[model samples]
Target: MQLALPGFEDYDRVCEGLQEKATKELIASYTDGREMNPSAVFICKTMINLSRNFDILNAKGRDTSRVMAQLLSWFQELEDKLPRASELKPEVAALLGEAKA
Candidate 1:
């Protein structure tokens, strides 16, 4: 099944761009003897959270394809924002590691 969000036809491109920018920024920060910026960390965390949620949704016998597409769309919308600590609970991580096969 194919699931997509309207007006997000360029979502893959946007995600790739964000990843590239974050990687460059992180490298520059490290080279300059500075800590990685919050924005870069936020991008990585956002991706990780999305991945974990997708895994959980799939393992729960849910329609993960549609939900994953929507989650990616939401992430695309909030690419510039940082996630709260409460959003990344240990329970969520455990769910991601559960059996889905």
Candidate 2:
């Protein structure tokens, strides 16, 4: 079965101007020099955005327990998809660790 790629329109609609640019830049940074699936890149970008928002909410004394749970769930899901450490490239493994996966 074929997987449907997400459209940029959704991202654009949700993230305005500078935020959109930042998200794209972050996605590029994560994908650069790495053999990553486009879907994974998209997921990472979303997680990064969510994380930033979570930080902001926490700093502002807003309730962010829900967002925190979501962020952790995403990390866990991504980590579950990763190959065993011994089978993965050191750099890739390191990146996974940085993601808290």
Candidate 3:
């Protein structure tokens, strides 16, 4: 997700390219119009925000230790909150088993 965010600009617009604010909000399943992330959305938002500035700061010779730390932490949190489907094989198998039963 962190890798995709830099290229996609917004995680919500993964393949669709940059989109309108409403579109991103909708795609991210944001409600109350807030991007607080029921779990991972906010982390994505923070990563996007951090990535945008980190490069510029680094180029300017500004230390980005804190920003990098925060960004890395968010990435870890995002992974914990919403792991890839591949990483959830056991959970997926359990769910599939339940559905079949």
Among the numbered candidates, top lDDT falls to: 2
Candidate 2 local lDDT, 1-101, one digit each (tens): 34446774455345343433554565565446555666665667667777777766766789988876886676565555543566688998889799995
Instruction: Tell me the lDDT of candidate 2.
Output: 0.63
> Where does candidate 1 clash, by residue pair?
none
Residues 1-101, candidate 3, lDDT per residue (tens digit)?
Answer: 34554556565543332222333354355233332446666667666667656765766789989877876787677667765445678978789679989
**TM-score winner:** 3
Sorting all predicted structures by lDDT, with the top scorer first, yields 2, 3, 1
Worst 10 residues of 2 by lDDT: 11-20
How many clashing pairs per prediction, in order?
Answer: 0, 0, 0
C-alpha lDDT of candidate 3 relative to the true structure: 0.59
Give one digit per residue, the lDDT tens place, for model 1 in 1-101: 35679987666544343334544454344335323466655655555555555666656667668645754665554433433334556886567557443
Looking at candidate 1, the ten consecutive residues that score lowest on lDDT are 77-86
User: Which portions of model 2 show Cα errors greater than 4 Å?
Assistant: 1-34, 85-101
Give the range of the ten consecutive residues with the poorest summed lDDT in model 3. Answer: 14-23
Candidate 2 vs candidate 3: the lDDT winner is: 2
